[model samples]
Target chain A: MDRFERQHILSGFGIESQQKLQNAKVLCIGAGGLGCPILLYLAAAGVGKIGIMDGDVISLSNLNRQVLFGENDLGKPKASVAADYLRNKYSDLEIVEIPEFITTANALEIMSDFDLIIDGTDNFSTRYLVNDGCFLLKKPLVFGAIYEHEGQILVFNSAKAGGTNYRDLYPNPPAATEIPNCNETGVLGVLPGMIGVMMATEVIKVLTGYAESLENKILFFNSLNYQTYTIDFNSNPELKKLIPDTFEAFRAKDYSLSCETIPSVDWDFALSQQNSDSIIVDIREASEMPKLEREEVLYLPMSKLLKESKSLLAAGEVYLFCQSGIRSLKAVTELQKVLPGKSIYSIKGGIAAFLSKQEESNTYGN
Target chain B: METKEQKISVRAFGMIAEKIGSAQIQLIGISTIDELRESLFDQFPDLKNMKFSIAINKQLASGNAPIPADSEIALLPPFSGG
Candidate 1:
């Protein structure tokens, strides 16, 4: 009795389907909540080659949903940690650990190697990046995203022709400020597990030719209500024009600029500029947690900061940060307009980046 | 021409539900996707700034497609989480 013997014995799935699973190469982006279950089932079902790509490290907050890592593995890179655990569990699994996020510069080069790509990332920038990259490469992309108790799953650009991609559903990302406060509004732990398994089911169907995969369709599921809706979508030629048609155009496009106008600096730069002459304004709302206790940092929500941009003219350098950096960039764009010659920078990845750095330093004693 | 009142049932999902304050709503005098959009924006002004798509009778609705009488319409906003 082998690990996939049960699946192999199913009516339509046999040794042939098992062979297909074993021969397939899939790249799963983001080893977070959804990535954990997607990777588990895909490996358990005998996927011969899998690529785990995530630039984030394990944190205490992630333990509840990221099932692959425990407290003992805290502060370790997600891609490497997930790869090591899967390798230990399965002897023949070929795992590629990409301990980095996929950017326009690397998306095409990295994604071109896989038969399919699964997007389990949490942010819109990466979501659009993965979808556009797969569209350019002509690879099947299994898309899954969660919001509180609800999750959305879809298979885009499959081997089947005339299917719609993510862009068709929402041609442009919602405004940065309009996006829900995800960091503050938490997700139900089991939501991703349910949706991830569904996404994995699509991957298997798409790869093995077992059944009808979710090509040209989008699924919406709410765990609280246990209600599911599968809607059919068609390619929008106008929306298709919004995506880059050629690889060069794809690489040249600034995907992040859709949310961020100015390129942000890392913790080092943000820290270096934190002096009496500079102001470190926290742009998160008053209720948001892990509030910075530093004396140099000022607490000003985005709403107040944008309205009060003129008052910051006296500050030497303005460094803004929000929970995850999106709002701060919006703030910088607004501030730059008011203070043309002034240096207003956004701390990339915001307080999350700062805290992750603290976690890394605490773990390594650097 | 005799005037007939058009009432369409709308189902909101994801963020749209939170914004609209209900999972489902009865929109009156809306006979097309464009009309439904105008009515929703008129009723919930915040929705005008928000991004969402409509699905009429389970098919993705685009370009002022007619809302069939008694059609089940869905308001879906893109979910960015995972």
Candidate 2:
């Protein structure tokens, strides 16, 4: 018996549609709650090539809804774990694992390989990045996001001509702390799974033409009362101008929550550039530990650094780092106002990212 | 002709509904998206900082378009959860 025998026997979704599922390539971003089911069904339906891109690791809390992994898979990279699950189930399935988060530098190159992109990420920055990247590449995108008991799904860039993108729906991102995510608000465990299945259905519809796709329409679903609303929208010409004009400009654009744009570098770049021309400053408070013991690394905390920003005028370039990348990015935004002419860069993942990378390398090297 | 303040039936969803303390409500004399926003903010001051889109009769409004009398309005905020 054929593997897709059930789908092949269907009247509308015959072998032709089954083959479309086998021949099409799809890339899914974020292997959390939504990504779990999206990946499972896509692979089970015989999607030829699947790409899983996520930078998060599985924690104990995620076992409730991220159904792909078990307790044994804790502390494992989501992309690799999900890819491995699909590969083991379907031997012929082609799976590509990207163990890094999507960024401006890598968005275009990573998205160019697939026919469709599914965004299940939990942040506004990555959602906008994927939306803009799909528009730039002219690829169909299935976007799904959730909050508590409600979820929203939209199929963008698949309308054959001019259609709505995410920006058309929300021209501007919400302020950093204005809107809360599931982390703060808390979500029902089954909410994302239900929404994720709908997102996957949309992907199948778009690829195989089994049904009318959700193009130009955004569906809002509330599982509590089983209420659903489908709203029609069109691409705004004025909003299209907000996207970068070219690939180079897109790469240079800042997708962070803050309006202030700052260049960010990895730990390696910050470490290598510790010279007389460029100085490295630890922006974390004096109480923070696991501190860098290098003589060249300065220990000026962010609180006092703002007041005495001019004290480091002699250095041609300034590199800032903190416990995590959040504070460092904010510090760069503040310091830029004080020292307008100086070059300031925030270390991408701060000390935590560097420590994790070192641990991974050690595990692999052994 | 006598002037009557027509009411618009507004339905809020997700965070917007949570902030307003109800999923459904009625607003009087709201003829445009901006006016509806101002009235909502006047009532629920917490909504001033929240981000949401206004849709009239199930169609997303890109600008401050005029709202017809007795239109079915909805307030939708972007959901960031996966």
Candidate 3:
């Protein structure tokens, strides 16, 4: 009896489908929660070549959702451990362990070798990087993301015509500080299992042409309520403008850095310039808490600044901040467009980091 | 004749839900997606700084599309975790 005898016996999935799966080369980025299930299913399904890339080590905390590791696996690099586990289980399955993190410098090169890419990363910067690299490489990307109790899965840039890419769905990456990962918000242990399996299902469907693909649709599932929704997204030609058109341009881009359009100043630097000629603009909305009581701070919300562009025209060397650094970066981008050549910088980590630093230093009164 | 006020049911997910303090919200007098967003920003000011997409009746909406009466609106922020 063959190892794939059970699956091959299923209707419409025979030797041909199994052979297609065997010939398929899939690359899964991030060996954590989503990657664990995705890699497990793909390897069990007998994918010919599987590449697991992650720069993180297996920690005790990750065992709750990252099923690929155990107590003995702690302190081991996730990529190698996951690869070894899969390889030891299946001798024929070729698992490549890449212990390095994916960055713009190596994303395109590494992704170009695979037939399909899976994004299981936990940050906006890497998500965008993977999306852009897959788009450029013209490989179908199976994307999975999870929050507290909900998960989202999508298959982008497939061979199907009219297929939408990640950029079409999200033209801009959300600010890094705005969206908290499972580490911060906390996710149910089973959420990633459900989402990752869904992604692996998409990978199989795309590889074997066994079923309809989610080429332009995003499946959003909430485990808490057991409610699932599929939202259709259309390809936007304008979104391509955000991506680099050539490999040279892509190589020149910085994927590890978020919000590169504007310059950023650390909390220490921002504090040093507090009483200097640099004007401090609080871009957070009026209702947000942890207000800066300093007399030198300017309470100008982004909405007001957009409506009244002339208010900041006379202000020299403007510094922007918000709850997180994201809104402030957006403010810098907007202000730079109108006031070209002006020195505009967003305070890194925004007021949240600044307040924490103040508390640490016991300088709230100052 | 007395005019009836229009109200739309809103559902927020992930960080947007945290900011709104509830998974569900009610926006009154909002006739379009943009209006609903503005109303949400006014009620939950922190939403202005966050990035999210709006969906109406299970379809991702763009621009100032008119909101259907008693529409099921969903505010979805990006989910970065795996």
Among all windows of 10 consecutive residues in model 1 chain B, the one with the lowest summed lDDT is: B1-10
lDDT of 2 by residue, A98-139 (tens): 987888988999999999999999878778888888888888
**Residue pairs with backbone overlap in model 2:** none
lDDT of 3 by residue, B39-67 (tens): 88788899888888888887888889989
Model 1, A1-366: lDDT tens digits are: 888889878999999999999999999999989999999999999999999998777777777788998878877888999999999999988999998777787899999889999999988877888888898888999999888899999999887835578989998877676765455558777888999999999999999989898888888999998999989988887898878999999999876635454757877987887666888899877645567779888887876876887677788988999866777877787778778989888888777667767767998999
| Model 2 spans with C-alpha error above 4 angstroms | A259-366, B1-4
In candidate 1 the C-alpha lDDT for residue A132 amounts to 88
DockQ of each: 0.74, 0.77, 0.54
TM-score attained by model 1? 0.85
What DockQ does candidate 2 have relative to the true complex? 0.77
Question: In candidate 2, residue A279 scores what lDDT?
Answer: 93
Global lDDT of model 3: 0.82
